[model samples]
Structures are given as structure tokens and as C-alpha cells.
Target: MTDSYRRQIDKLHDDVRRGRLSRRDFMIRSAAIVGAGALPVLPFGARAEEPASGGFMKLGLHNASQNDSLDPGTWSTSWTGASFNGGVFNNLVEILPDGSVAGDLAESWELDSGAKIWRFKLRPGVVFHNGKSLVAEDVRQSLLHHMKPDSTSGARAIVQQIETINADGPETVVITLTEGNADLAYLLSDYHLSIYPALDGGGIDMESGVGTGAFLLESFEPGIATRLKRNPNYHKNGKPYLDEVEFINIPDATARLNALLTGEVDFIQDLDIRNVSLVERSGDFAIVRTPSLRHFTFDMDTRVAPFDNPDVRLALKYALDRQDVIDKVFLGEGAIGNDNPVASIQKYHRDLPAREFSIAKAKDHLAKAGVDTLQIDLSVAENAFAGAIEAATLYQEHAAQAGININVVREAADGYWENVWRKKPFCAVDYFGRATVDWLFATSYVTGAPWNSGWSNAEFDALHKAARAETDEEKRGADYGKMQEILRDDGNVITVAFVSWRDAVSDRVGFGEVGGLMPLDNMRLCERWWLKS
Candidate 1:
């Protein structure tokens, strides 16, 4: 009777094919009872428009560090994730533009009675770029690659719940989790969890660049560019309309915009919100704006000095004028954040009063922490977000009234993510966000996660665990709400603003709907876009 119930019915067709239930049984048990027959045919993004077939497409993006490679686990930013996933890799599952979960390598997945064990039926005929056939073992090995404690992939913590993985047959993979998690399907769609072929070493060959995606890797120059050509044998029919694709790194927003205007690139992402009007007025360009869960924050290392105090964290939260940051830094293109990772666009988002910008409240909390003065260093780079440095300066000015001095550290754009972010006691971070609440938490806020930014709360953790296993929609939503409340008042990170996935583009690029589920049209632009004549 709900959206999720409708989704379950959509998979009923797969259920019928897998011999799990007869047509009559499926119809009687859930389909007809949930009005599946009356459900409208809803497709994510543009599915009805006829796609044009040829042309070279190039994109200017803010991601791509010199540390990049063909390895999926080493992919840390938009450049690597987009280039690799959009071109050369495929996950077990994918989050479509409509925010629904669908099979990528896996044809269908079924849950056991306890919902703790899940079995996936691999889609036949899917093959790696190397011409090797995809099998259940490849899926299992790729998953295990992320589960190891030494794994540095962003998805490591998300998949840590897996207790065991078994290849039931050549086409079947069964995963048993330590606990019931209905959210596992969406979790598998994490960008860092790309499936790879198992090699003779009992592991995947990371540098091969062999994948089951629409493009084959051509050449990669770390921190410079990446070139790829279409994989003619792509599984999707009539896909990868473009013959070639390239991703160029332009860290400065101005440089990226200039490249598009100068005909050096076909599309450019992470356009500064201030330049939105300029791009829109340009006769040769079009604005590609997508409302998204993307949010930027200044992370405070809770394990470090001063920030270790809860009162200090609260004081800093009240010192910032979130509206000013949105109006000036974001150019009024984004909404104010509530100091939580779960954006308002997501499910289980809590509706609460905005944290006020008041020096009095800030001073009050500072006094409670027994600190007369707070001097904090904030690491920042424009690459962190559209106007990260400008926002930090504004925050510094406002905090002056509350007896707080913020020393903003400007780092090089090339290695901001690797050098400044989590390594610094206070720094800036931009989250492209996830399709679900649990994925967001696990990636950035879970205890000791690689990007945890040193935030940990026992109460929040307990509630998160409970919410993951809760089958009742209403109760699960309530559990997540309580978790948000804890984060709102006690969390270390200051979530300042949520912005649209705004990009400035030449008229050369054409696509159906540009999705905001992740950066660069949900990392599928390579397969979904074509060049305009």
C-alpha cells in the first residue's frame, strides 16, 4: 500500500521467473492486494525519448587527484568515481534517477525469511571489457574486497555487516549479514562497491581497468585527465551513444567555466553558484541544475582538543549565520542545513527548528565549557565546495562577536581531500550524498569510519542499529528521527548548506533527465548522454 510495497511488487515479475512463486500465488499474496495492476509505469530519468547515436563528449570536473588509478577502492572523489563508474565499472546494484534500486550485474535478489540473508541472481551475458564472462564468484570476491579491515574504500564500513558470502552456483551469490538489514539493497549501490573479475591470485586485478560498463579505459594521467572509448558490446541496448568520452580536471571554478566558454570542454560540473546567471545568459550555454541532498560542512575532530567538549561544538554551531552563508557563499541557490547528514530531500528527515545564529547563545555555551576564548583552525579550499574559503571567512567574522577566533587555512586544490579534510582538526567537506539515510551515516558518521570526522555517540549508534532492523515503517522512521535529534544538538560537524548539483554546460551535451542522486548526472552521463549536432 506504500511506495516500498509497490517496489516489491515490481520485483514480482522477477520472482515469478525465478520460480519462487507461481503467477497466481504472487498475484494473490501481494500484487493484487497492493494494487500492483493499477500501478503506473514509472521510469527514472528519460526512458521514452529516442537517443541519438554518435559523437565525442568531454566533461570538466572538480574531482581527479594525482592519486587516482583504475582501482575502485582508491576512488575518493567525483572525478575518479564518475570516470570509473560512469565508464568502466558496474556495481551489483544501481540507484536510478528516480531513487529506486535496480539490478546492475545482478538480475534479481531475494531475501530470506529473517531478512538477514540475501541471494542475488546474476544477469546472463554480462561480460567485463576484457571479454571475460561475469559470474557469481566475481560478485562475491568484489564484495569481500571491501569487507577486509584494511580496505580504504568509502564503502568499507557500509559493507562491514556482511558475515559471510557464498557462491551458491555459477549464477547465484548468497550473502548472510550479521543482522537483519532491509536497507542492504540500497547499500550495495554505493559508488565505491564496483564489481570486478576474480583473477588467479584469488583477488581482483586493480590496475587492469577491466569492467562491465559502457566504456573501456584508454589512458589516465593522474591529476590531469582520463580518456575512454565506448564499449560496443555494452549490455544496455543502444547505449553509450557517444563514441568517445574524456574527463579533464579543472579545480578552479573560474577555469572550469572558461573551458566551457572556450570550446575546450563539452560540459563542466560544480559551477560556482555565483556564476549561474552568467551561464544562463550565455547564448551558447544551458544551466544543468538538479535539486539534491549534496551538503557541505566544517568538520570538527571530536577527538581533538577544545572540540572534544560538547559545549564547544554547540558554541561553534550557533556562531555561524547559515542564511548568510547560503545567500552569499551559495548565491541563494541552496537551503540551510540542520547539522545532520540526512538532507531534507531524503526519507526520515526530521523537521526541526533551525539552529539560530546568536552570539549570546554561543557565549553561553562557551561559558558552560569553561573556556574564555576559542581559537580554531579551519582548513579550506575552493575545491572543497563552490565557495568554501569565502564561507569560512564569513564564519570567522561572525564568530568574532562570540570571542572565537577562526584561523582559516587555505590548502592546495590538488590534494585537499587527501591532505586537509580528515587530517586537520577542523576542515571543510562536501558530501554528494547517498540514496538512503543509512548509507550517508555509515559512510561519514559511523564510529571510526574513514570519514567519521571523529563524531561518535552511543545513543545515536544504538538507534541507527535499531532502525536498520526495524520492519515497521512508522517505527523505523521514529527511530531515525531520534538519531537526528542527537546529532542536531550534540554532533561535531557543522552542516552549513545543502546545494543543487549545478553545472554549466555547452549546448553540445544532450541527455534525458540529469540526475542528482550523485555527481555528474548520477555518474551515468557517459552512457546516457550524447553530443548535439
Candidate 2:
């Protein structure tokens, strides 16, 4: 084979290893390059495992809050996502295990020539738990719920781009966008855009929690536990192998680990990296580490004093020893972040220069900011992530070397997302990461977005708008690359590391390839995983 052909094969292999491309896709592309007769033997576990049916599965998850709601727009934590959104409801599109978008509720979709209009054909014969047939109207109204002016949905910025949503008969829905967005389908796969039955009065009935998903909600108690049972009439054939699934909220890492150890739960997400060796030695459990776009951050409100100064923000970024945190807290299982949310595996990821840890540079930036010494309060909770408290303490020590006093405030985990994050000027936060760069930016960085940090720049906003509308691949990539640089240099959020999604599953459970976009197999464990018969 030619050297170029060999390089192409190598690239495909790398993509498969990183979970960015599916094994099936790799085989197809590789066979085309080398004739079918030259194909190599299939590796072990290459074939899909047949899913066994009928058993109970329970998951111990963290970050569940009392403020959790059945309303898709209000759902945030993994507790609600894994129990309700992933099992009890379905989005128009779904991100597959290989990080590709596939039809979920929508059987197929067509984009107009200008890329400004999209038409989705609903999957027929699909019915919600209440026996209501899935229709185009349900999709329109479900999305409209987040587009309302008064809506507080986290997906508001994403849906606001829709100029109109019209139902064409019972099965087809047309969406007109104010501007072209090539990533619209991926954005629709967002958990907050789950389809719900529409009310006769022109709004979606989100409070009911009824959806055309694989499982039905049996009982729910916010911040506590959610119980669900298999949907007898689920559209996905042979799915929801578990007879019942339970998602229990366990904020304490030690308690969650103990529950998994004692067989009280079949699986647990956000596995404490420190305990990986213990689980491995036990032989009763297996670790699923999927590299993801998930990043931990220390957000500073630019509207607040001291942080308002660009030099002060720069100083803080320089003071953070990202490698140290990744080594000590994450057990060196993650990649050091460049203050950018985009992961190296994703499209349009720019390989920006790594920001080195230099106390001298941090002190210099503080001097430039007209401050001899700096002091800041960093609010944190375990709910932010598995080792957020320890990460904060390490940050405090690192900052002290640069003449910065960081007061670490340990807050209660019950209402951390509601009470502390985005409310405090400086605090620790974590994002499960979105499927696309545009979706990630629209959700957390856009001006007027609900989850936006206090920093805003007209230039960055313009680039974002331009990039979203640009259909040219080369130009679009350049625009996105510029945006990453902008965030890295001037943004208020300090991204510490892009960590992998680590979860522990019982040996009794069986599954196929796992998704890396979010924890618990992209929060679809209940439907995709099954017990060993």
C-alpha cells in the first residue's frame, strides 16, 4: 500500500480507539481502501453483544438537587437526565456511541438548499406512556417550550434561533431558522429538548413527564430517587432490557462507592478516580473510562470587582497548576485544558499553546492589574464533581505561591447548582459537555444566555454568529478556531482539565460500546444496558 493509504488507515484506527468513530464505520472505510479479500480477522468483542432482557438495575449518581423538575427545560443534573430524559423521554435526535447524530423521535430529516430550513419526519407508530401517538405537533410544541420569552430553560439560547415551527400534517414538522446552522440536528439532541405531548391550548405539557421513550416514570422524588419501569409499547424494538430501573442520589463519594461495593446499586457514575485501583482489584466491578469534552472550571464573574480587570483574570489562570490538579485529583486520567471548553477529539478543536504554571507570570499580571496582592473566595461542593473540594484546596495552595489568597468555602451539596454556581463571583463548576462546539458555546458563553459567565465581548459574539451561519467548511473552522483563542485569552472561566467520564458497572451487567459525551453512557444506561441472564 502507498504511504498515504497507510496514513489514512492509521487515522481511522486512532479515531476508533478514541471512541470518536465506531468500529462498524472503521471496518467499512478500511475495506474500501483494501479489497474485501484483504480484510483482517475481526478482533475479539468486535461483534455486537446480544442484549438479555428482564432484571432490575439501580444507579448511584451525584449532583441531584431538590430543585430538579420534570419539566425538560428545568432539568440539569445527571440524576434527572439518566432517570427521566434518557429513559422517560426522547429528543428529536440522539447522539450515538460513536459521537454521530442519529434519528430518535424524528425518523428522518431534510435540510433546504440554503440550510435555513429543516423538515423532520416523525417516527410513526410511536406512542407515549399515556398512549398518545407521537406527532409533529408534539415536537414543535416541545421545542417551543424552550423558545418562549419567559422560558428559563437552559436550552433557550439554542432554540431562540428558530424563526418559526410549523406542523405539516401529523407526521412532518418544518422549522425555519433566522440564520443557517449546520449543527442544528446535534443541538436538538440536547437533553433539554426532549419531546413532550402538546396541550390543546398551544403549550407543551412538561409537568406530566410523559414521553415516547423506552421507559415510564413510576415514581419520582427530587434530589432523592426516581423509579421507572419498562414501557411495554416502547418504539425501540427489544430495548429497555431491565424490567425496572432506579436512580438514587448519593452526593457523598464514599457513600456512593460503598453502595456500589455492597451491591446496593448495579452502577455508579462519576467514579472517584482514587478508587479505580480498588475496584480493579475487587474483580466484581469494571471501570468504563470514556474520554469526553467534560471540563472542570473555576468561574469568575467579570462584573464583580477585581475580576473585572483583565489582568486579574490572567493572573488567576496563570496561578492554576493544571497538570498538578490532573495528576493529584484526577489521578492523571485527563488532558490539561487550555482554558477552552472544546475537547481535542471534537471537530474544530484548536491546538492552542498550553498555559504554563508560573508564579512569576502570575505575580507580574497582578502587578499589572495595579494590585500588590489579591484575595478571593472560591465556593465549592462535591456536587460540582467527584474531587472538587480537593481540587479547590490544591488551587488554594498553588495560588498562595503567587501572593494570592484563595479562601475555599465548602458549601452544601443539596442545592449547590441553585444556590452557589453562577451566583457566587468565584466558584467551582463542571459541565457534562455538549455534542457540538456551537451547542456548548450557545449554552454557556453566549450573551444573555442563562448559564453565561459574567464576561461578554462584542467581537466574540460576532464571530459566534458568523460561524454558526457559515456553511463553508474551511471558513467555519477558522471562525471557530478564533473563538477558542478569544475564550482562552480573555474569558473569565478557568478551565482546569478535560477529564474522562469514569463510571463503575457491576460485572453482572452487560453492554456494548459506551458513549463519551456524558456519564452513564451518555445518560442512556437504562435503555442501552441490560443484566446478564
Candidate 3:
């Protein structure tokens, strides 16, 4: 058998072990690959094939700029998200390929008798890229770095519930929470909690790029490209097989697609839905498409005029034709989205009926709001997400039927996040999605979350907190369902579609066996992938 087919089978075998792959699907894939005569009998639990390491892989990605910082708290774009989390960093814990929590910097953990206090045992002998030994104090300090009173990090609202954090010994760190959080361990895997060596002044050095990940930062030029070399002293025995990697920022999707086709880049994060067939016809590159938690939205500043009125928000929601947007913009590669952040795969995501696209209802809601005809600025940019400009244009046309005049304001791609996103009264945006419902709400829906929630809805905040504190999974799920319902009808956000991640990759790269939790193979492609040649 060819080495490439073996790698694919290896991943399939692991999935079968993890209960993620169905037996029927496995049999079909297996039957299609190799015939019964040429060693067709596949044995279970056979992963003896080790990957061939050493080659450089260039990546083309989107949504990066000169404002990119090494600070974990400031990673808003996928360019930075994949670079920081996938490259030069490690969390205390991580979600495994099979969707279970596992230790990264931490070896193990246990809850105190009250379950409100948790203790994590650190892995000794691990050294940062700066050569500082990983210690309990460093973990505690790294976490506390996000909770500083004057901090503006998106993670601030997440770590605020921690009452105290202290090192119990040279190797043990303890966290005391004001209340019990059943999902605390999952929270630690938040990409913002990347562990870093502490400075002598009781703070982390945000300016320096130092971490304990599988790769060391060779060079980082924001909005341009970053280079890395394998860390010889990395803790994982045989990981980060690639000897060198480069992440190049290519904002324009056509240029990015051409780059991959011409072999300038081995992979790119997003593939324009329009080009899926063209790339397939070329056959020079392979396409990797996976269902994801990512979603697109048209957000409003609920604190501002027109949007502040719930009826206006409802009218806009009714004005949206999700199916039409999916067909025109997404090219029918996405599922419909409710007005909530929770994906259908999430635990508490209820099967709420889709909101009908009715121009009459939209006009009725506008009349109810005491507004005869409304003209609003609807800002859009390519950086918002793939197909954002086209989506906004479609929305503009749809709103016209309801007597709403949506002035489509096209913005520059470079500074949209800083200048247009939350700064504008309304804009188009996207979310990579959080691992859990609590984390999702905390990032966008919470009252003061740094990611521009715009609305200060008291009931949603209370329900979110109560759900987080509940220990029973069933009870917590119920509370989270209620929170989603409130946001759907009464929040300032209108989720238009949930998109699938479609990546165009060179056939040289291989992901042998893995559960892709986040985009780009849980944002660890650099660490887990290898060049077949």
C-alpha cells in the first residue's frame, strides 16, 4: 500500500477507536481505497506507521494586519489565532482530537472537596522558548495577567470569576472560584489562556514572543509573514514533525487561491465558495472541507439609535432571507443560523423554528416601532468573512422590499476591525465559535465582553451566570437553551448563516488521523500535519 493511503487508514482506525467514525462509513472508505486481494483485511488498533518528518510548509491565511500583536489577549483574527495558538504557545489544558479535555502544560488536576477549588499538577522539566522552567507560579501569573483591572482583553470577562489563584507548592497550582463551574477545565483551554513565563515585575512580558509550544518564533512581521523552527526541547515526544513552517498573510481570496495553485503556499485557511468547482477541475490541489462551529452575522450597536429599539432589531431579523443569502453568498455550503450564537452541534442548541422572511412582518414591526421608513448604514468588508460583501448586498436588496433603505457602506479590509466593526452602528462580522455555550455567550453576549456585544441586556447576563454556576448538565443545558431563546428574539445580533470551513491544500500535506475540533484541524495544523514527500 502507498504511504499516503496508509496514513488515511491510520486516521480512520483511530476514529473507529474513538467512536467518532461509524462502522458503515469506515467500511465504505476502506472498500473504496483497497481491494480485498491486495492485503484488504485491515486489522484494528494498528497505528505502527510513523510519519516521515522534515520539510517546510507555507500557509496562506486571511484577516491579519500590522496591528497583530503577540499578546494572547488581542488575537481577534484567524491569522493571529492560528499563529499564536497553533504555533508558539500552549494552554494549561487542551481539547483532544476526540473532543475530550487533556493536559498540555498541566499533567493532571483534581477538584477540592467543595468542588469550588481546583488544583493542577504542572509538568516539570518543561522549558519556555526563553529557557525559563515551567513552574506553578508562571501558570498562576499568566492567568492573572488577563484579569488585571485595567485590562481590555476579550478574556477579561472570562477570568473575572476567579476569586484567587496561588501556587500551593513548587509544582502545584490551585484556583479558588467564587462559585462552582462544571466547565472550568474546558475554560482553561481557552486560546487566550496560553501559558507564558512571568516577568520579575509581577506581570508577563507582552512585547516578547516566548512560549513552550512545539515551534519557536523565528520572526514575526505583523500583516506580512511569520517564520518558525522546531523546538528541539519540546515536551511531546514526536510531535511538530515539520522542521520549519511559514504563515503568510494573503487577504485577497483570489490571490490566496492562485498562490496555493502555483505552489507558493501549501495550504490556505479559506476557499472562496465560488472557486470550489474550479479548484476541483484543476486537480493540482486538494480541498479539505469540514463542518465547523463558525457563523456569520450582521451585528448592530444596540446602545445606538434605531437598533436600541427591540422592534427595529426584530424588523431587521425578519427582513433577512437566510436561504437566499446561503445560495447567493455562501453558494449553499452552509446551514441556516438562528439569531443566537449557539451552533446546532452545541449541547443546549434548541431546534428553534427558522424565522420566516416576510416583508409584511418586517414592515409591521417597523410600524410598531413608530418608524415609517428607516435608512441605516450597513457597513461591510471582505475581512468580515468570506462572501461578506455579497451577503450585505443581498441583505440590502431584501430590505428594500420592506421599505427599509440599507445604505451599503464598503470599508477597507486593512482596518475594518478597529475602525468599522464595533465602532460603526452596524456591520458584518464572523465568529470562529467557542468550544462551549458558556464561553460563546461570555465572549459576545455578556454585558461588558470586550468583543462589542453593544447591548447591555440584564436578563441574558443573569441567565448566563446562573447556567455557568449550575452543576447538573441537564439543568445547565435548560438554562442555556433559555438564554439562546432570549438572544434570538431580543438581542442586537442577526445570525445569517453558519459556514463550513473549506481549505485548499497541497496534496503533500497529510493529517493522518485527527478529530478537527477547531478550524484548521483545531488550529494545530503546524503541529500535527506532515509533508508526505
Top candidate by lDDT: 2
Report the C-alpha lDDT of model 2 over 7-83, residue by residue, as the tens digit.
Answer: 77777765554345544576678877666335353321222457899999999988788888888887777777778
lDDT of 1 by residue, 163-269 (tens): 99999989999999999888889988878888888987678878788899999989989999999999998888898899999999988888998999999998998
Evaluate all candidate structures by whole-model CA lDDT and list the values in order: 0.82, 0.85, 0.82
- After superposition, the stretches of candidate 1 with alpha carbons farther than 4 Å from their true spots are 1-49
TM-score of 1: 0.90
Off by over 4 Å in 2: 1-48
lDDT of 3 at 231: 90
Q: Cα deviation of 82 in candidate 3 (Å)?
A: 1.3
Q: lDDT of candidate 3?
A: 0.82
Question: For residues 263-342, could you state the per-residue lDDT of candidate 3 as single tens digits?
Answer: 99999878898888888786567776655578899999988999999999999999999899988887767777878778
Could you tell me every candidate's TM-score relative to the true structure? 0.90, 0.92, 0.91
Best by TM-score: 2
